[model samples]
Target: MDAVADHGGSLGRASALFPQAPLPWIDLSTGINPHSYPLFDLPATAFSRLPEPARERTLAEVAAATYGAPSAANVVSAPGTQILLPRVAAAVKPGRALVLGPTYAEHARACAIAGHTVAEVRDFDALFSADIAIVVNPNNPDGRVARRRDLLELADKMRSKGGLLVVDEAFMEVGPLDERMDGDVGRGGLVVLRSFGKFFGLAGVRLGFAIAAESLAARIHGELGPWAVAGPALEYGIKALGDDAWQQAMRERLAADAARLDALFADSGVEVGGGTSLFRYVKLPDAPALFETLGQQGILIRNFIWDETALRVGLPGSEAEWRRLEQALAAWATRRQERAMEAQP
Candidate 1:
């Protein structure tokens, strides 16, 4: 497992790294939705008071319904998915932990933090050997999905051995519905993590949930303790998660945006390998140069430390932002062409 580097949405670091670049940088580092869920006025108590127990329960119920968890008892709320990573890993005692990669680096680091010897395996079959096996559904960076039936079989194997199977379904909001393991967590030996911020475009709200059997859910909830979530976060999460109409509309919009992005990349002669609608993964020899070009032009996309040739580009927010991205890619393409011509005999 590699030490954690900047994990996207790093405009401050980007500003310092590219000091001379333009102002108001376009940050498309993470897979967060560019068009955020609508915000509204909150009651004064929601800000001045600790989140009421009833409100918290309501939020949990809403989350459970939204994510298709069996019930509110199976869902544990947290400040963010990142906070739940180590807790999820710690649910099982330290042992041989295997993470399916190249995915989110935090999973491996979290397992190590939980006192496990962490190994990242690319093959699905290889994961069956570990005491703790982690799979990111519709995996990050690349949208490779393990089938639901395959995952259930793997979970059954791990469960039989008293091991844990962790499925990070953070991107599943935009991924295949049938492939999600949220509904199966009640079968035991599995934990499904759902991220609200990515789909709702409310990362700043710091909301995430873990779905598992009631006992495991309780254990993870105990780790969080009372009032783990903030007042503003509770308000935003409750209102947004329950709004089914908004989510459906947003999903459709994101699909359209993803198609537009694919077309845009194709015109620039870049191939999109795979990614959820919220982001697109581009793996190319010139990915490094493209990353630099975007950064230098005040547009920041996510680049990887482990895979030098891989970059993740998120959706552009507005028409202006889209045009800017287009212009930046055009500039990079021109520079690339000029270099190719220079090498010609």
Candidate 2:
């Protein structure tokens, strides 16, 4: 297989290599919501490969509306954010870019693929002081969000130096859709990439978009070619965009689910570090052990190998799933306590 296993809780690759286990694992490593927007209502005609003008208009309008784009120039759709990242790197040709540390590794990977020297802003000062910054809003893995004003200031500095500021807003819509840094994109050097995968549960559908000024949008679109999105992706993308009711309900449910995740961690002595409504990043004394324990119980979660001491886990959809995770954590805690007791003087 040509695929890389970089994501949290990707057992499919492993399953392909080895004999599959009996009980299927509940994958929580992905920051995506377990309660997905229903796609059953998508038009039967969506499967056709014909150029869908109405579908295209709906996608463009709905995406633009959701992001509160200052102008139609602000929105460009993609198969998913993954493909768009490479396209943006190709279009912008940014060199000496600084990626926020411990972010989605794919950002750096994309920059590297584009032949850019990707330096990580590791120290606190570099993070606050980088001239060109690619900050992932509600960052991946660790889940920390940068302050808005600080981010704006960074963008301004980058613009002054003729550098670009790219932010991955993939998880931003999980909270307030309006919290997007829309006004800043027109400042000439800023772009925000949003994903339809996480919040809308459209990961398999591969829908994502970018918000940029007209010039930049045109340039990026040119590099990406016309009609980069598939027929099913484009059709569903429009339907997904036009549906505000689903977005509202998802937000409300995720907020509640996030609260429950916090409580579960607090009760079990696992310190959840940061996340808004969609996912939570946590630090446990023994994240690998916890990951194994949870995995054995068929409750798969995200654990960063680079930081073996921390893990990221997503909240489940229903109360039953939540209860299952809660019980698994309780059992894991008891095991830890027993191990500690064994080592006591």
Candidate 3:
């Protein structure tokens, strides 16, 4: 991971790095929703305040309800999970933090930056022995949700070791809200982080929440400065969260799209890991070339250079976009097959 190199998708500097024949690229780099919540055009005054107390209360309440963290006192708001992640690391400052690997990049980054000894638990085998566990429910990239009973048992085992279990539930909203990790939430050393921007499609607002045991919550709140969330975001998030109908529709639509995308990519000889409705991680032989090829076709998707063999494609704009992707992928697969033949005697 170069410090200043663009990795993939729309903003990747790879386009600028090879500008001779610039491709019209579509970005699937981020797992964020392509369709956004209806913005009401917030008032200028809404952002003028450093912190609007009333707005904070409302946003917290709505977030609590949305995340099933009905106990308001345990919730702390931040601009985004990215911001809260490092903050949680700093607050906990554990001697050792165990993070489930092949998941979000930010989790490892957060712990490393905080100077905590970090260990990656690769799978259930490792997780069974992992003393302190941090995981993303409905894990990122793969969208693999751990069995509820297994995860709860793991959390208990970790707690008994005097360790913390942090679960990032950012994409859990893609499924039924009830499927959230509400179990064992208030247990000592158990922290759950959620992002409002994902399911609500309000990334620009940069809103996220931290739920923990009361003592831990107070510690994190005290460490993070006052008025952490801006007034406008606070107001907007509350309204968006209150719209249960919208969230439900978004889930149903994404489920349909995920199914459609799985079928489309299957035609390209790619297998989708996990059960995500927002994005599908397609396993391919050469991700970098596949990414560039897709860019040349005006299709943008996420490819991790380090992985170099997995492409995470997001939901297409419409059925037309899906068709476009499917067609381009089919052609690419033909070319790949031709190349494979060429490599043969």
Candidate 4:
């Protein structure tokens, strides 16, 4: 099979492929929140001048509280988690890097690009002696979460060897609170990466944070230099991170939306394997056909190259989009039934 698209949210590419498809595409390709944070007007200085140090400090403080990070000293801001991944990989001297398999591809890619010998392992046992170990908690595309105790154990082992354990909790916001490791960062060699865009639905703002020990965070901050996060991103992030009421409401909403998505898949005769509130993972024998059919209907989702039988479906933003997805799934089911009948002897 050809390589699955490296990432999702590529409506432009989808449109190019299916020129005759309808407009106003219903994009559920990425795990980004559909219900975005309400944007507010910003001061002219937010656009005219460089981001104030005070604003940056405030954002970090808010992020620390939101992430339950140990302290502001442990938080480092960046343009996006994507930008920080490779930088963090490079900052840690290239060595034996072990990544929890079939998770985010970027972790291995970043390590390899930084000259580390990267290996994909299936279990935590393999991480004990590795110079670096990376995991995506509530693993993307499948939402498999490693227990916090296991992760802390691995981190302790790696720390003993003067190694690092990097956990990408990009989707953890939609997961259980106890599964997070942000507050555990002071354990000497644990680093937690948080994405501001996925949960808040502001990918365009390009903001993310890394929570680690003060020394490591300072290293990352120095590498990022001054004003790594844009002014607008700083302003927006400060507000969004500070809004506890909104966060609580969004969690409940996303959980309900995920259940709705699961029901849709079940009714369509698709089997849901696992996933977080933001997306569901389906295992179908004809996953490629389903992906193509949905794309033809101007509905895009995520498919993994390593697992051809798996397709990741994100939640629809509105009721209209939900109806569209339901109709498309109904059509797919009908076609499958017709194909089954034709194959009968």
Q: Give the winner by lDDT.
A: 1
Cα lDDT, model 3, residue 70: 48
Question: Candidate 1 lDDT, tens digit per residue, 18-91?
Answer: 89889889999989999999989988988889888888899999998988999999999899999999999998
What tens-digit string does per-residue lDDT give for candidate 3 at 45-144? 7877577677777777777787788477778888888788877776554567677867777777777777777777777646645445678888877777
Q: Scored by CA lDDT, what does every candidate get? A: 0.92, 0.75, 0.75, 0.90
Q: Per-residue CA lDDT of candidate 2, range 1-345, in tens? A: 133357865777434433343356667878887887776665566665564656655687778877777776677777788887766765555566678877788877777777677788765347434434688876776666676677777777767776677888888886444446865688777888989878887689888888888888878777767667777888677777778888787788788888888989888887777877878888866888887777777777777657888788887867667778888999988988899999999
* All-Cα superposition RMSD per candidate: 1.4, 2.6, 2.7, 2.1
Which candidate number maximizes TM-score?
A: 1
TM-score of each: 0.97, 0.91, 0.89, 0.97
> What is the C-alpha local distance difference test score of candidate 1?
0.92
Clashing pairs in 3: 26-300, 79-206
| lDDT (C-alpha) at residue 30 in model 2 | 82
Candidate numbers sorted by TM-score from highest down: 1, 4, 2, 3
In model 1, the Cα lDDT at residue 326 comes to: 95
